[model samples]
Target: MLELSPILPIAWLLVSLGFLKMPAYKACLIGLAISGIEAISLWQMDYVLALKATLEGSVFALLPIIWVIVAAFFTYNISLHTGAITHIKQFMSSLSGDRRIQALLIAWGFGGFLEAVAGFGTAVAVPAALLIALGFEPFLAAVVCIFANTAAVAFGVVGIPVNTLAQITELPILPISMAIVWQLAPFGVLVPLLIVVTITKSLKGLQGVWLTTLISGISFGLAQFVVAKYVGPELPAIIGSIFAFLATVLSAKVSPPLRDWKFPREREAAASFAKVQA
Candidate 1:
């Protein structure tokens, strides 16, 4: 029981957020209170030290994480106002009309790139928004984007996460980055396939585009591994995502889907048209 005391706050956070489906602010506040109580009672932490730690953490969140999110939103608004978002949607649509392919392209590939550059939920926010704009159901878009952000997260924001780990552990960044890449590379390959399955909600969804899915995954995983091994952590997500995007686009061109998969709205429209014709 004493040994497990350290994890109680985290467990409470997970339960509150995941099971209770509480608002993030409320969950975090409760979790913070729990942590403070545990520190004071279980760990015998001095009140002053606990207060200092909390202040430092709050400052860290405000300065780096919050600022990055603000900047990303600012950039997004600029892009939207300038009509760049519309052009991006058009360009992605031109790549492939299949919603499955589009999910892989936007959620996996583009989201990875955003994670590499901006991170701090920018990957999730930007990709999900693009997907919704492209006619994906909003909840599904959010879920797919969240899944797609996973593999790229280790090297996100120019490798801040890995660098921070290395700093804390007093280890060389390269070996740490390489090891992380090795571990995550397989998931990088698997996530695209998973995204497709999630979008289509059926095993049969993989039937036509399995090859393209494999191509996107393999290219992303391979490129991430190579870059992390040689070029260090900074470029893996960015370069790997670029490679995946290009590879997916080219392979899709070489072996295009026999019939482009339509979104639910498009399918409904087509059915209505058929009924009218009948």
Candidate 2:
């Protein structure tokens, strides 16, 4: 059974996500039925204990997952019902005409702003869906939003993690911020580059203005260092990403005409362009 813990996860994945060919809801029901029946058959505990375990397991399973999904659908519904989503896309498209810029604005900047507020899956789903609505491919939008959310995860909720660390460690806020930057500065440097690499595939994404990304990373890294060094802990995330985003504008200004630039393969572009035309 000790060994089974990892194996059980594999079996669970196979049933829910693979061979069952069932939707998530149906898979969940099947899993619950299997667990309940197995518990009874194995006589793992007294009936009362089994009942308690079952209830506990269900609550553990549902609460956080349900909270995330409920919050996601709620934000999604707000976008649909209020039409904040429309204005949002207009806001994004107007920011940059390039599809890549649209991805960064909607997924990174806007997504970071939302994550700063909501701190949940809404950060990704809402922005990615917005990008998709604005004519970006779904997968591309998801990838960028995921990258954009990283910068904010550490300090969002008005710097929750720093606050918690300060409280527990009884250290001053600056040191905690310093410690965070120790790990976060590298993470910040990597994400923007990762977004480019993921979208275009290979180092090919770095083809145009690669130095600009490096310089932008330097700007962000310096901002984080300053926030960790002189500025208060509360400001590193918002300030760092803002500086980084602004620095990218330099790349837009300096890079060669994008049409002349090459990506991994021509066939892929033709297929993608065909889809866009369709």
Candidate 3:
């Protein structure tokens, strides 16, 4: 029972956030408070030391994590103000008429690029918003962006996360990155297909596009694996995303899908015209 004490606060946090649906900040603060109490009572930590540690952690969070998020948002806002985002949307839409392919390109490929350049939540936020602008349902867009962002997170922002892991674990960055690739690479391949499934709600949506999915996944996973194993962490996600994007685009050119699927509302006019002709 004593061993389980450490798990209580985390359980509380999950319940608060997942079940209660409390605001994350509030839930996190409550969890922190519980952790502090446990440290003082169970671990017999000095109050002053605990306070100092908390302050240091808060400073660290502000410096890199929060700072990166703010910078990313600011950059996104700049693009919005300059109307560059509109051009980006147009270019992405031109890549493939199929929403599934677009989701793979923007969420998997483009989101990975953003993750490589700027981690935090930037990769998810920017791509999700872009999908919404392209007429994706907001909830589905968010889900797709989040899933796409996961595989690249360990190497995000030039591999900051893996570097930090190496420092904390007193291990080599290359090995840690390589290990991460082993875990994430499979998921990288699956995310594009999963996003399409999530959107279409069936495996039938994968018709005529299995090759594109296979190439995208294999290229990304192989690039990530090779880069992490040989080149080091800083360039894996960047290189992987680039390779995946290129491979996917090339595959689409070689074998375009037989049909493009659109949202029901978007297809309403075309459906009506076909009905009239019939």
Candidate 4:
């Protein structure tokens, strides 16, 4: 029972959040209450110490994490109110008519750029919404945005994660950045390919666009690896994102996909989209 005491609070969180469909804030508060009880009783932590730790954590959450998210949403909303979303959508659409390419551009390339600039919640939220505006199903858009965000998150917001890890471990930032790059580089490369698979639901999705995927992945992975190894963490994600975007766009010009891939539903949506434009 003592050994499993810690698990109870976690289990409660999982069940509440996943099964009960509880709102996240409520579920978190309940989990925190359970954790505090366990800590006080089983762990014999002093009440003062527990309270101090919780206070510190709350303060930390309010600063960089919460503030960053707020600023990102504010900026996004400002752009929306200013009618910039339509222009942004048009520019992305002009890049490639194929939804696969568009997904890569917005989710992988643009999301990486946002991650480099803002980190945290901005990357996924902005790009996922952009994809929806571009005609992607909401669920697919969200999933792809998450997939794309993963590649750049290690070095996100100018390598905040690596820097934080370095601070916590008392290790040199460069070495830590290098280690992270080595670990995540392959996944970065595969992320774009995975986005296509997720969007198309078929391996045949890569048939005519293998080169584009390869270029995007290799460009992003190699740039991230090299920058993290040589230039320090702050610039790797930014550089990697730029390189990947350029490589993918130029490759598309040289070797356009032999055929566009679209889900039947998306095709119907496109027909409606055309009518709206006409």
Candidate 5:
């Protein structure tokens, strides 16, 4: 009796997350069921058209997503079998034992590199796996890698999003890339901040992490902005990540040590972390 928008969809989401204790995939199903019921009741006169809209979304979800998932699996399986990835970790750790640095290089740097080429779940999973193989805990690896890959997704695979948007909309790619950088810069910084917090278990790394995150984000965003603005859309993702990688590397080397490390006795959380580290 109530309007569907006013009552049902929100109910479905809440019930799924709250009552049924369902995860996201199943939550989607609950939302779909609610929508289907609404559509059938409201569109009784043109149920076919309503059904067509529903089917259209399923069709779109099926084609591109399945292809990307299948391709990522192939890359992951091969990389695992080849043992080349282990060496990649060994090479990484030899450079720095600080997990934060490793996260920046592998998850942020190398993950971004994969995004420049792969640009999907593959970019996230592959680098996440590399982080685990290199000695990070699983949750740490997963979060670090996933978040790192996302910063460049808007321009990834040689600026696919901007390129395609430009082509379809007939907008200039340069302005599009610049706008994307504005959106992406904060996300870029968030990537490093996430990794450090994931590993350090604090916002303690915040000061240095913020510094590194901004530098990397700015470098990559600027590189992509400039290149896409003047040159074209074809290489921004790869080039920008390369620039980010270099920027973070240089920052890690030059950052001053946290000369005033202390955990006040009253700060239980800080005290716990100190004990944990020791």
Candidate 6:
């Protein structure tokens, strides 16, 4: 019974948050109450020690995690209000008309940069909004952005996640960051290709743009690996994203997509017209 007591708070949290659809804050408070009670009654913990632990955790979360997220959102909102985001959207749109190329640029490259800088939700939200503005289907844009966000999250928000892990594990930051990048490198290389696949809704989407997509992914993965190995966690995502963006642009210049590929409906219409002509 005592061994199972610790699971009660977690089970209540899952039930309240997942099944009952309670607000996160409320569910957390109730879970905290349950934990406090369990610590005091079941574990026979001293009240002062329990209180001290709770206070320390609350302070740590407030100062490091919550404040950082708040600051990131604040910066994003300021950019939005000042029309900087509009200019950025315009700049991205001007880069390429091919939807596949644009997906690589915005979702894979720019989204990774956003994760490096602000993180939390900025990477997914900003890139999805840009894709939607570029005439991508809303659902597809969101999905592609979500897919592209996977690997970059390791070093997200100036590497807070990695730093926090190091602190918790009492490990050196450099080795931890390097190991994380090494593990994530394959995913980093594949996520860009996956984003393209998601955006096009078919493997045929890689028809002509496969080379460019591969270049973007390789550049991103290689840059991240180098930075994480030599520099640290804070700069890997940022440097990797920049390298990916520049490499994609250069590759496109040298060997652009063989044909301008749009969404499924547009491609079908073009195919039908070609068939009629033939």
What would you estimate as the lDDT of candidate 1? 0.87
Better of 3 and 6 by TM-score: 3
- Which runs of model 1 end up more than 4 angstroms from their true locations? 59-84, 163-173, 273-278
Q: What's the residue-level lDDT of 61 in candidate 1?
A: 88
The TM-score values for the models, in the order shown, are 0.84, 0.66, 0.80, 0.80, 0.70, 0.68
Give the number of the best model, judged by TM-score. Answer: 1
Instruction: Output candidate 3 Cα RMSD.
Output: 3.6
Expressed as tens digits, the lDDT of each residue in 1-278 for candidate 1 is 67998888899888998899999999999889988998999889999999999999999888876776567567667878999878878888789989999999988899999999977677887788778777888889989999998898878689888888889999998999889988897897789889998988987898789999999988998898888888888999999899998999998899999989876779999999999999
Specify the highest-lDDT model's number: 1
The full ranking of all candidates by TM-score, starting with the best, is 1, 4, 3, 5, 6, 2
Please provide, for model 5 over 52-111, each residue's C-alpha lDDT reduced to its tens digit, 9 standing for 90 to 100: 988998887666655666665576567679987677767765555556777777787878
Stretches of candidate 5 above 4 Å error?
1-25, 38-85, 207-211, 253-278
How well does model 2 score by local distance difference test? 0.67
Query: What is the per-residue lDDT of model 6 for residues 1-278, given as tens digits with 9 covering 90 to 100?
Result: 89899899999998998799999899988998999999999899999999998999889878765775566556556767887767766776566668888888988899999989987577777777767766788778878888888988878788888898999999999999888888887897688878877777789889888999999999998998889888898999999999999999888878887777888787888899999999
Higher lDDT: candidate 1 or 6? 1
Return whichever of 1 and 4 wins on TM-score: 1
Candidate 4: lDDT of 157?
A: 83
Q: Candidate 3 residues 1-278, lDDT tens each?
A: 45877998899988998899999899988888988898898888999999998899889888866776567557667878999878877787677888888888888899999989977677877787778777888789889989888877778689777788889999988788888899986797788788878888889888888789888888999998898999898999999999998998888878999888787788997889999999
Could you tell me which residue pairs clash in candidate 4? none
Model 2, 28-96: lDDT tens digits are 666666666666665354778777987897786567545765666577668879888788767654444
Q: Write the per-residue lDDT of candidate 4 for residues 17-136, one digit (tens) a residue.
A: 889999989998988898889889989999999999888978888886677656756766777899987897788767777889988888898889998988757788778777776678
C-alpha lDDT (0 to 100) for residue 149 of candidate 1: 89
Error of 2 at 128 (Å): 1.1
